[model samples]
Target: MTSYVEALEHLNQTVELHEKWDLEKISQIIARPNATNIQIVGTNGKGTTALFLQKILCAHGFNVGLFTSPHLVNVTERIRYNANCISANEFGKVYMELRDIFDEKQLSYFEKLMVVAAEFFCRHPVDFVIWEAGLGGRLDATTAIKNDIVLFTPIAKDHSEYLGDTLEQIAYEKFFVSQYAKKVYSSPQSQIVQNFMQKQAEIYCKEIFFIPQVSNFYIAETGTVFDIDNQKITIPMLGKHYAQNAALAWNAAQQTLKQKFSVEAGKQALENAAWPGRLQIVQRNADKYVFCCAHNMHSLQSDLEVLKVLREKDILSKNTGVIFAVTRNRPAQQHLQMISKIFPNIVVTAANAQHPIPQELQQQNYAIANEFGDAVRVLQKQGIHDYLIIGSIYLVGEAYKYLELEVRS
Candidate 1:
């Protein structure tokens, strides 16, 4: 038997799935007998929404399985029961066992992971399964499952290479997740998304529920507070945008369970929810640094809004420093313009070989560091009050490792 690390490395070398694969073949390999209730979430906040649903369902005494993608630290994070990450040994054992099946019928990296997770869920016997779309919904690997519920979060320009260039085009691709959904719940979206969703819902014959925007949310020095469905709760995470994300999660949970989920339980889970690499704080010496995997324009804009709000409340000082990096596929100029608009004093760094820091941005930014470690060192030496590390997940992952923060699940 090959070692788990070897198996993981081998899988990583395989190509990613473009769209859906053979569902019958996948089902034959991985039994999903207990996957009667499935929810497919798209775009930003999908992971958080899935986590919220998992907590609420578990609180209601239901066994829940959660499947998310592009894990920040470990592959085990892709699959979970309740709030716990699947054990490494268990993941290794499952992968090693499933390898023979993959060898028998060639599968992509994501395809293998999806099948492994499905098989694991069947063995675990969860009452409900929350599956996050890896990319666009229409042909995503997760679409192989016939979902009972479909959820959509705020959609913005992302994966332009594959999805599309315009918002309408992108929304069209994401709307594909609604095909298998019996009922749909979506956060209030733009006219483009709403119109597209309406058209899709009519064709698919699925009821659509729109979560209202959070009216009143305030951030304190320690955390944030907001009201959802008349239930006021506090979450340890920062940003008013997070309050909206939590509200969306709460509404989705209520809609799915057809019962009033405990506000206190949801609040507690939100407090305990450690979505690392998303506005996560890492400390080095006396400086407090925040790392976020904000790759696209929408997320970067949201993060900037939160930062502005934090600055106004005096939670973050103006002297904060920023270290930015992104993937080559992303629109680097647009992201840099947004960051420059929000943060004047910034330092740019290039990590991945494919996506080097653009010369234009490097010229605009006061400092440019070729390496991640050197970027951190240069930022620290500048005596900035607070630090923000933004861009690709790879950048945040590398920063997490350098800080000696827990990386493995």
Candidate 2:
């Protein structure tokens, strides 16, 4: 029996997307398994939204399986059953059980894991399984499965290379995944994006429930608290967008009950649910640091706005220091300019994800580091008490690992 670690390493090393990307054939391995699958797609918000749904449904006493991408720490973080990680031992068991099928399908790194998740669900028998698309919905691997519901998070122009240049084009690619979805719940979006989604609902003949949001929510350094209708909910984390994600989950949960959703589970699930990397806090001695995965221009805007509010509430300080690194494709100058508007001096470092520091970023009044730790050391030496880091989730994940910080859920 190859160990789980060994098997995962082998699979990851062998599978390549350019060689094979047939999700339909890979999905067939677990196609006959008894499960009600829901696929959520968007440029942002899918991971948090999926996590919210998982916590809600699980709190409702239903067995739930959740699949999300770009794990901040362990790869096993990508798959969960009833709020518990599918253990490496079990993961290896399932992987070996279907190892031959995966080799035959020639699955990609992502597709390989998704299939494993599907198999894990098949073995455990869950009430519902939520799959978050790794990329654009219509063409992504998750759409290969026959899903019961599809949720659309707020779409944006992040992955311009594969999805499209404009928001409309990206919106179309993501919305089309729900063509066969019996029900669709979407978060509030830009008017143009909302209109496009409504058009998709009309074309697919599926009902679209636009989830209502509360903008003036509460955010404390400890966490954020807000309500969904009559349900008073609190998350042990930061970010205003999280409140919106929780609301989207409430709407989706209502669909499963076949009646008005229960606020009963809302309190417990919202309070306990752990979403890593988005406004995550790390405390080293007396110094406190906040790390958020605000990768793109739109996400940066949302993150900076939240920071401003936190500053108002004393959750953050005017003297806060931010460390940032962006993926190579996005306009580095614009991203750096946005940061400069909110933060005067920041640390710039090469991300473990391997995106080089942009020249424009170097031109700014920023400190450079050979690695993320060096950047943090620069702050630590200066006796900086507050550190706020934001950029790609990959960058955040790298920092998470380098710091050996254990993040909650």
Candidate 3:
């Protein structure tokens, strides 16, 4: 048998064939003997919300563990401590110990990682664990854990095949985490999601906290300011959507701590919170490049809004070239339509995988490239400035590697 690191590499090369619910054996292996405080974050803002909560809790003197999915560049980015990626040595050590158990039981890649993360936290004794669901909430491996608080970010149309078709059906699947949670907090979603969540709340007997939408948000070239829980706070991140994510994270942290969060603490934490590959700016040859992993149509729409704001403010220009790609699972037409609306000059390319690309796009643009490096080379050859890379996380990860930007510490 190969080492755990080698096994992880092999797993990444193959397609994920196991069901999400089949992770029960792995979960049982990592179950802590003590009552572990858990919060399962779902939907769009899972990474940001989890990072924010981890920062706030660490400030308040709590050991925090955050597990997020679809790492930007390295697999180690998926597991973090207060916004910092764990070291490769530490990861290898943990994997070596857990590999024995996994090999004995034959756990999947995701399942093996979950068990290692849980056992690492148990031994280290973290005060709270923020676990982001890999996919939809219903059968997600993270759902196996009993949660102290469950958080649902905006439920937009995404992962249609596995989750569902309509927004209501998708909302129902995400709400499944509430069953294992003591309480739940959700941002203001669509009417369908709100209605579904209400029904689920009643059945689960869990108190649901709704984060009201921010009526007034101020955005500038430097950052953004918004009222979260009636406290006006300035964050070092752009986008009106980020304010909503922060609000949800704030409410969840307050609920978990069972106290009014310090305004100064919340403000500082929000300012410091960082999640790479989402509206993240990279500088190359004195030009700005924005790399976002907007795989689904809804997420792409959000990124488009931010780009529009930037263009209006002269932060980004209309001539900015877009490096776009999509996975086989997503709706390519909808993604291309929405992206074309925002970015007039897009260079469509394929991510470094066997994912399908639309034939129509291939015929129209003739911009398809075999690998991420080739895609970057093609964009650079065109003398394009202010580049924006959008589409699947795999594309964003490859771009991150090419740019060599350090992951947030």
Candidate 4:
């Protein structure tokens, strides 16, 4: 029997994506015909949206399995049942069972994880399986399975290399997975992109519903409240963007389970749902750190809006400093410029070799650190207790590791 450590070693040897393979054939090996699957795809908010939907369904007395990517602290975080991640022992057992098939199929790292999730869910049958795409919906491994319901978070221009350079191209790529879905829904997007998507849906003879933004909302220091269908829904997480995700989840849940929808259950689910590393606050000694995964330009704008609102409401200090980092593929200059407009005290750093400290960022008046831990040290020496750490998801993961915090559902 392969241990979890050995399984991870095998997975680490594989690449993130492969140019060619038969994902459908491999996925069908563990396909559960009765298991309803919801596939979510977007540039940002896929993980959070899936989480919100999972919690909502589970609260309504349905067993749900959630599969997401880029685990913050542990690989087990990718395969979750209801709200808890798959235990390491179970993960090792499943991985060992699939090892021979994995080698035969030449599966990529993501494909192996997807296979594990599919098999795990099939064995422990759930009412629904929420599959969050690892990349663009068209070629994403999650697409290999039949998506009973396909949902799209706000589409943006990130991952242009694989998806597309233009917004229309990106939207079309994400819409591909919806071709066979029983129902399709999306959050509000740019007018141009929405028009493009609508035209595409019409050509395919599939109707796509676009969810409107949450209108009635109140924000306090603790959380935000939104009035949905005259039902006061309160979520513990801050920001209107989170409210939008909750609203979308509520609408989707109602649509998916028309007669089964329970207001009390939905409210409880929304209140309990928590997404870490997005405006996540960590306390270490006397210092406080705020971590957010706003890697791309679109997400950065959304996160900054939340920060601005927090400052205006006096929930967050206006003098809060920020530690910024970026992957090499991202435009460092543009990100730094955007952050500088709102935050004067900025410290730049990198999480790993893939994300090198940009020369442009270093040339600025901002302080630089070799990595996330070093950045925290730099802030500590300067006596800056309240600061925001924003950038790549990898950076946020590093922050969690440095703070010795474990990520949970």
Candidate 5:
């Protein structure tokens, strides 16, 4: 294909069905068993948590291949090796090698990417292949590869249509990744999910442990600092969730490296670890911007709480402008109302045209900005110096494009 986008378009011509997902064929195509697979499964925070783990492993000087889904900008962002995005040229070239498999096996869009990521990782000297499940774990394409260590992020009610409708059910579906895991780590989760995961581990005869509670846990306008495993860690991030992610990465790395790993290396990893679009901060002159990827209600609540704390500390202005967008399937109005409760004025727009046309926010203070430039214009005209764009990662990409925000390291 001429371009990665074109290759995807061509793949779209294939019918969408399970018959196209021949994992057996995919495995044979990229048969390399040198890499240890790490599957991170969750409803939210999986991307950030996976990045956390990847960053720590890289800091320890391990070759890491990381893959996450639903790219905001280029598709290459979904695949990386040692913290570097895979170039489209390389991605296209590798994918072309398996062109016949695409036609013969009928791999769907997501399945195609999974095979592509696996094949690319196999060709490299990657020591750790961190695969972040795109959705439900059991039937996810990544599940085709049995993981050596499985990290469970916070699983809540998301993708209910396919996964399940209830929290317990969703949690149960996600824990399937742990069935074959040699080791398992849990991020702080709801009581129901934590219990469900423990039960699953019992059935699988695998021991599962949650990230130990940190001592002297503190969140402030400056940053977050905590003590875990007798190690003092500081991450310059707003939320406690980030600190928990750091601990998960640290624990997982410790489990892998054993005595060779040092507390000092863990601290350095946490300090430098950052996942863009997750409470990401950007500045333009005197004005400031905070980009958060709050997709579902669970994540939205978490990010809102962070903002609440920031507002209370007077770090973030009590009043600000919001650029909000959500996927079409979700109730746009609910997100609008929730965001309105904080920032009354909002610019409602589509993150990308792929999203269903956004419903007009039927509020006197809200404006519809189809164009990113127009969205910025509305916020600028309102004299809102502090701006927050949230709801969907795709929307964050759109805002980043307009603002020219640099990609995170």
Candidate 6:
């Protein structure tokens, strides 16, 4: 695997999670970073929260390495040094070194990437390292490495097959990621999830801090403003949900640094914070597209709320329709129904051949397309200039590919 393409090909050999035996083995062999390890575990906002915290810490002049999953554009998105993704050459070089260990342990794709990130972070020593769990945290590959601080972004029911079927069962599984942490912090969550997390904290003899209520919040066309603990900060992204995620990052940074935390720096850092595939607006010639990664029911609902707010503010056009696609496991019909509430004009399409639109859905009233490009053409033919490409992250990736959008980081 001398090239990035080849490395990705090798990694795809095993896409599913295997036992942790391989992860445990890699954990022992990798040169672990001495930086404070913060594990982010939750169903949604994990990546955004991690990005916010990384930006906050980096703004305070601390070197930070962040590892996030399910890259929007490139594989290098999983590993970052000082918030910059590792270059393909560097990713391949490091991945090449671990080929033997990868094969020896029969490690899954995620496990292999986790080790690569660990090694990459070790090579580029930083003051802090943020590890975002790929899925439910307890048995997630990131948990294989001990963490000093654990942060939970709103827990919700997702990956029911692997986590559980009920909300309590799912939240219980995510709560374990904070068991070994010296300190635990979380964004606002449902009462049930909060209760379970509190109980878990008690069992671990740890104190868990929940981000305080937003003193005030406003969603604007430009961005979302949040007033927390008398600090007025505005994040580049829109929506109250994003404001809450920023609040979580703000509090976590304050607690992590205590006296060293700078309110001004943190506020400024959040203002510049941005995450891909979360209501991201992309312009393609004369047409405008908003790509959102609302794969599961929870995320789809949350994003629809944002979309509703946007529509009310005139930030999103009334004529803006949606291009919906999802993975095989997702509830496509349910997601389409949710989107239809705010966007009745939708075109159903598949992110890839492996996850095609269900046959039943193909017979529905909605317009159908073969792919993202076809979806866009279908909308354009109807004189719909503005579009919302909403569904799985892979769908956003496909849309980006169709637009030939380059990965900035």
Q: Output the number of the TM-score-best candidate.
A: 6
Alpha-carbon lDDT, every model = 0.74, 0.80, 0.74, 0.83, 0.79, 0.84
lDDT of 2 at 343: 73
Q: Tell me the tens digit of each residue's lDDT in model 1 across 1-409.
A: 2466866876777765554355556555655546655655556777766766676677777788888887766788888987688887788888888887888877877778888888888888688888888787766767778677788888877888788988888888888778777777888788878888888788877778888888778877666677876777766567776677777777777665564566667666666655677766666677787877878877787777877777787666777888888776677777877877767677788855546876666767368888678887887787775878888887887677667688532
| Clashes (candidate 1) | 0
lDDT of 3 by residue, 1-409 (tens): 2454664664464346544356466557776524345655556877777777777777777778888787777777877665466677777777776666776776667766777677667666677788888788777778778676788888888777787888888888888778877677888888878888898789888778898887579777666788876777776667777778888888777766776466678778888776777787767776788878777766777778887888888888778888888877667777777877777777788764656465766887547776777766777788776888888877887787787877773
Candidate 5 stretches greater than 4 Å from native: 1-33, 360-365
Q: TM-scores across all candidates?
A: 0.91, 0.92, 0.92, 0.94, 0.92, 0.95
Which candidate comes out best when scored by lDDT?
A: 6
- Global lDDT for candidate 5? 0.79
Which has the higher lDDT value, candidate number 3 or candidate number 6? 6
lDDT of prediction 4: 0.83
Error of 4 at 338 (Å): 1.1
* Model 6 score (lDDT): 0.84
Q: Assess candidate 1 and give its lDDT.
A: 0.74
Worst 10 residues of 5 by lDDT: 356-365
lDDT for position 369 in model 4: 87
TM-score of 6: 0.95
User: What's model 2's overall lDDT?
Assistant: 0.80
For model 3, name the residue pairs that clash: none
In model 4, the clashing pairs are: none
Model 3: which ten-residue window has the lowest total lDDT? Answer: 33-42
Off by over 4 Å in 4: 21-30, 359-365
Which is better, 4 or 5, measured by lDDT?
A: 4
Off by over 4 Å in 2: 14-20, 30-33, 259-261, 353-365
Candidate 5, residues 45-114, lDDT tens digits: the string is 7887788788888888999999898776677788899979988788888777777887777677777877
